[model samples]
Target: MNLSICVLPMHEHLIKVAVVGHPSEGKSSVIATLAERDDIRISARSPETRECHSYDIQVGNQTLLELIDTPGFQRPREACAEFKLYEERIGTDNIAATFLAEHGQDPRFDAERKILTPLAEGAGLIYVVDASRPISKDDRHEVEILRLTGRPRLAVINAKADESTHMDAWYALLNSTFNLVRPFNAHRASFAERMDLLRALGQLEKSWQTDIDAIIAAFQVDWQARMDECAEAILDCIEAIVLLRVAKTCNADDRREKERVAQQVADSYREKCAKRERECHQAIRRAFKHQLFDPAPVTELQHGLLDEETWRLLGLNSRQLRRALMMTGAALGLTADVALAGVSLGVGTGTGAAAGYLMGRYAMQPLSMLRAHTRKDSWLSRSMRREIYLGPARNLQIVFVLLDRALGCAHLARNWTHARRDHESIMVTRPTAATKEWSQVDRDAISRYHVAILKGSSEQVYERRTAVRELLVKLLAS
Candidate 1:
């Protein structure tokens, strides 16, 4: 299909949650467990994803929320030993490296990287350590990394059924490190256990309570404004075409000709709407300074890939490097089209440029930043204020972009359903005035049309314009 790209106004709001941890800590398994829904897909194993993988979890209709799984820190036995010797020579009393060195040769370091990167990205850490093993200094070091991330974190001691003594020590050590601690049997963690984990996440901050509310409010307002502008743009296109159609059909009183004109107008609108959606996606990526949409490796190691010099040069724990690469790849694959389309449509062009300047001046209206700020009342509230201020707004942007795409498509197709059952089919068939209509067809069509415009899909805008042209043609014929 020939696609004509165009710029459409964009709404800004998104939430980004990064899940971090050491390698082999079941980070991927956790994501798979959380995203059992059909819409979500976990990428296949790769060197980078050995630590981090990001998933865009669909929470509701027209919403896409991001969850980034990060790698854990995995220090090799030799590295751990060297680190300990270095620390000892430096007169430091830290023994975490010594403990890790003793256990590093064990298969456990592989799991550590799977857990740590996500934690560092401010995903409320879900530290999962083997309860069957004795509480060691390595676990303590992992906990220290969690603490350093400064995000609200919880420890999940994966209870091994036969080991009660080691579990006790694990619990004690976890309590000393994290504010919340829970025991989970990963092999057989129940749904209730998962809910308990979510509950722990919910209780971490009161910011969760009011933050989403404010974000939703801001998004709704901004989205509505964008929709109105889209409607206006569509209407303009329709009026232009309708006038031309009326002139062509000299029988200005023929109802059939008028209907034909409206159909044509709607078709034009749909095309424009599709283009706009592409533009919005591009704009969002540019705003974040993200070039590739799919995750790509940030660094490469040659010859001695795991050498100490290479590790130090990368500046990331094995898990962090893994997650970063996975995230880069995922970002590249998932949103490459949007990025390319946005650039082509001038979505990233600065206000100094004519096209961009015109858009900012005519399309987007600035709102007060005061309303987006977080309120502080108590000590806990003060501590959570930063998260409250940024998290919801970020999440809102993510939701906005996804919804914009879905709604924009719906408007072009002139139909909206709660499910994606026939979305692909609907997108292929161009609607015309000859199609059977239900009650309030015009209003429904117009509402969906407006939604498409707001979301910035050139295809939908074109479809609506085409329908309007067909309607005008029928009017003129009558």
Candidate 2:
């Protein structure tokens, strides 16, 4: 028997960042948001993180950054007092370890030891503080203790939903102890805010700059890829909905009976299209890495999608839709004016509009092909003379309806913070007004994409999807 082992090269260049602060100051929330992991512990009732825990930011096989979550400082004032005793005796670099040794058995300093051990070992600091509330003596003392460690540090002001009266006080206080101070609301900050924080993190230390830049670059690339995947998912779903067809042989010559049975098959076709659109939404959620069972969001969209409210709330109105179509048509050198009546359509009824109406596009002409084909039902004899084909989705408006739902869902996922743990939903509330007009570029890209998806091959579909993805990423940026 031969024994073989493979040793994976572990990179030592990964930056270690320790997030610390007083209890309930959002130390864990900062880690949860930065790591983008909803599974991490975040509590509203009390402090959650009781010991040191690590979360990694990895790209493919590489780990670019490691965030260490430590227990919040329980005795910051006393810890600082004890650590200061040796500033004149022992060197500044040794005061933290000296405090840990002397207070290891002291019950009050238990949390302090847990927080200081990471900093003593060379991790840069991210001191989280509540900027919404006025700074207390305890907050100041906590910053002083972290400062005594003499490590490169960044102070992060974690503003809760409504705590903003002390932003200036926090900035003025934190600037004295840390290299940089930034006010960030972990629960509601958008993608751009997070990126801005990362950029500031890179400036805390020169040696860690390379790793921080790598982290930022990898994050940006991953986000763009996710948007592209979402676009692809939407396109695939649209194709399935358009090409869906169900047929049965008809024996009776009565036109009424044929239409009735055709309606039943048509219902089945609609059911499948609905299911495909749902899967596409799921795919978009997965692309955004939101795996939590969030039925609230889905239910809200479903109610709106079923009642046809989301189309009115988030999608382009009739005028915008018509204008979009005209713009799309102009890009393709076709002069087509479309009039779309806004109505509350059933699941697969006259759905939403795309570039106004694409009803007569050569690639989208399903009526001629639908009526020309016939399939024999195995249950019926060959004497049947007719086959009724209900659809290949000639109405392009329904595609817009599904696209609206996808966009709505993606928007929620992009802004949602992993720090939240409840059934709280995103995009649940109706917007005060309908969405604004899309830029000519976004509208034109959407129009061109509509054409490619209708007639293009797989490669062409991918190319068009990529074009749309570029615009989506810009929208998601902040």
Name the best candidate (by TM-score): 2
lDDT of each: 0.39, 0.67
Query: What TM-score do all the candidates reach, one by one?
Result: 0.32, 0.78
What is the clash count for each candidate, in the order shown?
Answer: 137, 3
lDDT of 1 by residue, 6-57 (tens): 2211333333455544444545445444432213222324424554556653
Candidate 2's TM-score: 0.78
Candidate 2 residue lDDT tens string, 107-185: 8888888888877778888999888788888887887787888988999988875856777778888888889998788
